[model samples]
Target: MMYKNSILLGTIGGYRDRFHQFQKDRSLEERLEIAKTIPRTHGVEPVYPQDLGADGSGAAAVKASGLAVSAVNVNIKTEPKFRDGSFTSTDAGLRAETVQYIKTAMDLAADLGTDMITVCPLIDGWDYAFQADHQKQWGWTIEAFAAATAHRSDVKVSIEYKAYESRNHIVMPTMAKTLHLCDRVGAPNLGVTMDVGHALIAGECPAAELAIAHDAGRLFYVHFNDNDRGADWDMLPASVHLWQTLETLHYMRRIGYDGWVAYDVFTRTGDNVEAIASTFEIMEDLEKILDKLGQDTIESIIASGMPQQGYRDLVKGLL
Candidate 1:
């Protein structure tokens, strides 16, 4: 059976504490030696870039330590002290900074042999009045990204959508909305980065959306996390939609989606090491569940006029 290049899952935001607690002031080289030992279904593990104090010892340090870094995620909203009241502010200084940052990341990805980078337009703790302004800011950000990546066809840009956590809300907070933004950006390198957890939180079936995006030719990247209907973001793995996740993987296989499936979660609540290991185990189990289902059986059930509940039962039987 054909599959995407292997599904590469890695920690984006939660390894800092793990490094400090377990490494005991060891250098990043030592920390990466530990990261390399974690068992993964996919051979590649990419770390997200964030500031690491005055020493500049975060992702850059990790990359310098010789562990393979395949992707880098830039959180634009988290930058310090670039306060612009509106997206249209177009402060020459801010634009310059944003452009330079993007270029630097693109260069870093090329250097590391990474194929994609994700940009999240998340704003924190804003009021209703900021919604329109925030949307405009996202538009501007998209334009800036398009301009920055116009010449770099080797690297792809994924725009991730979230519903009401980082900001009071997000403008393009759904797969459909994200597709529209991608159309507006209209760059060859621009595409939607689908996060399964965000889709579940928005009360949408991720499997259905994956099919829709695949049909529309807009699905480029994926993030795997889970949340219950009533819960906030980053709840846990398959907490609300185990069946949906299975269906999602199956659909990706059906549509021949060959892209990265990175894990986007926080490990602050407990032992980060165990949490990461357990999450990988769960993901592997999910994949096995999909494998046992077999594409022909799944397609036959849907064609047989069975209800969605029956579909779930069919998958469970395979499991």
Candidate 2:
């Protein structure tokens, strides 16, 4: 049950927000080539429409690049019409289009020889109180997922929940709520993509979040990145929450998450390639450290349930 380490190809290109552009842009071919040169990451994920359009050129480029397709990241946020909301949009037509687009994304994932797709409903939330009808939007979200899951049973559709970003409060802000969405939708293919940074910003321990999703048997994919408690900065792994990331890695192995452990890191001044490659190196180092500590010792510490400072002493070894 080894995890497949991967990188979201978008992180290596020019990163821009409303305020500034992080780096110069690179073509899809260039991004793919750069990814192939990095160590420990044998898989690369590309975005839908933006990177891999319906024209099949992007898919062909990925196949030609020789790196495995970890998962196809469907773009549900960048489009203009989806600015206000996507699945939870007040416009019925926009909601329906989003569901159809998800189905199309699943099709593309299958075409690219993968069975998983990660989606983040980034633009689907509210900015202020009473801005959205909670009940109706929740129902629409359920309906959209139901339709997409019904369209295909072979492909796994995973939702990436962010605490907040473009909107003040996102509709699916937590993994528990997201699993409820899966419950309401009742789709076997539907699951959760536990982004560590998102979980941290939501005030939840990444290890605890992993335990919950894994217990529910809805853990489909994973995104790895560290962040300060207040913001999802997408910093290199273990940069801030070293302890939590270590605990999460233990839980990830315990749950047997044999999917691509992709990254969502963004660098404004540093070299994006170096940042991503070093991120993977850190993860590998953490896993090796765990080996040094021994899983039996850590599990015994957890089972002890002792505020007896059981595994707390292990941090000294890491330092």
Candidate 3:
């Protein structure tokens, strides 16, 4: 596989949900140390401001850990000031601060020898209809993103769209909508960071999303996780959607995607180290099976438009 892997910082930090929370809260140094032990991984994906050290000491810590940076996850939602929204905030000052923060993150990414940053604007959405003017918010967001991306040509700034959670309906909530931002901003470096779990939450097929993004030349990055077809569980890859995982990997190869596949799993109560290692282990299993079956063979089945035997062949390959 040409694809490299990165451990999402949240995976090692600690996981929590409505019913459960992480047993222990480990420091960033401890998490990175654990990250260095995971084999075949390219690096760690840390969030800005929270996981990053703005004073330069944090970068030194990362360098000492002997792991490279896959990408900087820019967080614009946690601050109380951004509770209403970041990019789409009604306050012009807040919006401008958000843009400058993202720009700084891009500069940090370049300084760290990486060219990618993932932004999940969870707070930039409305909970109900007629709460805000959609047109105005959209324009504000596009202009904010345009300024951020225009800061540099080499750094790739991507939007990771989610269906719901922080709000009822998010501004950028799908691959197509994310592509819309890329189109509206008209920046070559702006793209989509397609999170498979989020795709499932939005009731979309991962393979199809990859094909669309690939066609757009905006498939900047990928985040790998699974869910039960409803919530954004962020469970281990292939834990619930076996075929979805296989199909997604197949399409990635078909689309010539060589970017990082982030292990965005939430260990909840499981061992963190085990979660990291097993994510790669599962990918190895699926990737090998795909190779054994052959991409051309699988494509032949899909091209024929015959479902029964095609699926049978896929399942039989596993046995």
- Per-model TM-score on C-alpha atoms: 0.80, 0.96, 0.97
User: Could you give the candidate ranking by TM-score, starting with the highest?
Assistant: 3, 2, 1
Cα lDDT of model 3 overall? Answer: 0.87
Any runs in candidate 2 off by more than 4 Å, and if so which? 309-312
Which regions of candidate 1 fall more than 4 Å away from where they truly are?
1-31, 41-66, 82-92, 124-126, 130-139, 308-319
Q: What are the runs in model 3 whose C-alpha is more than 4 Å off?
A: 18-20, 54-56
Sort order, lDDT high to low: 2, 3, 1
Cα deviation of 312 in candidate 3 (Å)? 1.8
lDDT, each prediction: 0.63, 0.88, 0.87
Model 1, residue pairs in steric clash: none
Question: What lDDT is obtained when candidate 1 is compared to the true structure?
Answer: 0.63
Q: Whole-model lDDT for model 2 versus the true structure?
A: 0.88
